[model samples]
Target: MASGASDCHFHGNAVATQATVSTCAAKYQKDLIASGKIAKSWAAVKEPASFEQIDGEKGKEWKVTFKDPAAADKSKESLYMFFTAQGNFIAANHTGK
Candidate 1:
């Protein structure tokens, strides 16, 4: 199915600790993906993941998670997006039904 998801993914690596930003809010994330204007955004977003540090390196896991209960309002389908450690845009349905 074609959706505003799988837009970006950022693998945790040495270079990622520089403090990057991602769309952690489902509604805003989907909106950015649709408009292709995520980069130009300067909004309030917490995180789209959570993680556990390992071997002195950022764990290969999500350290934060983004969500918006309203996405389940039946009027909208939420989207998740982020940049991988390899620096690629990825958006997807993190909540696999």
Candidate 2:
């Protein structure tokens, strides 16, 4: 993952072709895993899914924030995914240290 800073894009569901988990964020998580950004172990880190509306470069977008399992240090990390209301993957970020 591109640690620390956040990056955004306007992508589509076709770009998210690696969904292995069952959560709503699976597609986004799968993309991270496929790109070797996040570890495969993170596939187990699925919980605390929240929804929100954000102002995207194009317009408003739907964003989902999923909390990963605690790290070895007991610190929590989060995966933020932005998508269209139709469930297309737009962008994602893996935030943790």
Candidate 3:
């Protein structure tokens, strides 16, 4: 997490605050770029296209989506990053599955 980034807090349970989740998503995106999983142009995107909480069979999860106009494939244009309720990264994919 970056300096002064919002801290994760608990509301009944250990759930990450939206700001904290957003920061996590951003860091994950940067990691993707560094690993050559995504275009370096992704670094230009300062914010996600959307952020939401998903309710699944296991439990709650956070999704941070970013749109990259420079992507070679339309299906790959949207990067979906998933994080646990506690702000721990789970996985990332273009399929959003």
Q: Which one wins on lDDT? A: 3
Instruction: Give the root-mean-square deviation of each candidate in angstroms.
Output: 9.8, 9.1, 4.1
For residues 1-97, write the lDDT of model 3, one tens digit per residue. 3333343332445678888898878888888999998888889888999989998457999988999887878888889998878787788999998
Model 3 TM-score is 0.81
Instruction: For residues 4-96, write the lDDT of model 2, one tens digit per residue.
Output: 112233333422211312244665676788888866767786553677766777766667777755545324367677765444556776541
Best by TM-score: 3
Q: lDDT of each model, Cα atoms only?
A: 0.39, 0.55, 0.81
Model 3 lDDT on a 0 to 1 scale: 0.81
lDDT per residue for candidate 1 within 17-71, as digits (tens), equals: 3134343234445566567664323233444544222221332422324444444
The segments of candidate 3 whose C-alpha lies over 4 angstroms from its true place after superposition are 1-12
Per-candidate clashes come to 27, 1, 0
lDDT of 3 at 87: 82
Answer with 1 or 2, whichever has the higher lDDT: 2
Ranking by lDDT: 3, 2, 1
Error of 2 at 2 (Å): 32
Clashes of 1: 27
- Candidates 1 and 3, the one with greater lDDT: 3
**Model 2 scores what on Cα lDDT?**
0.55
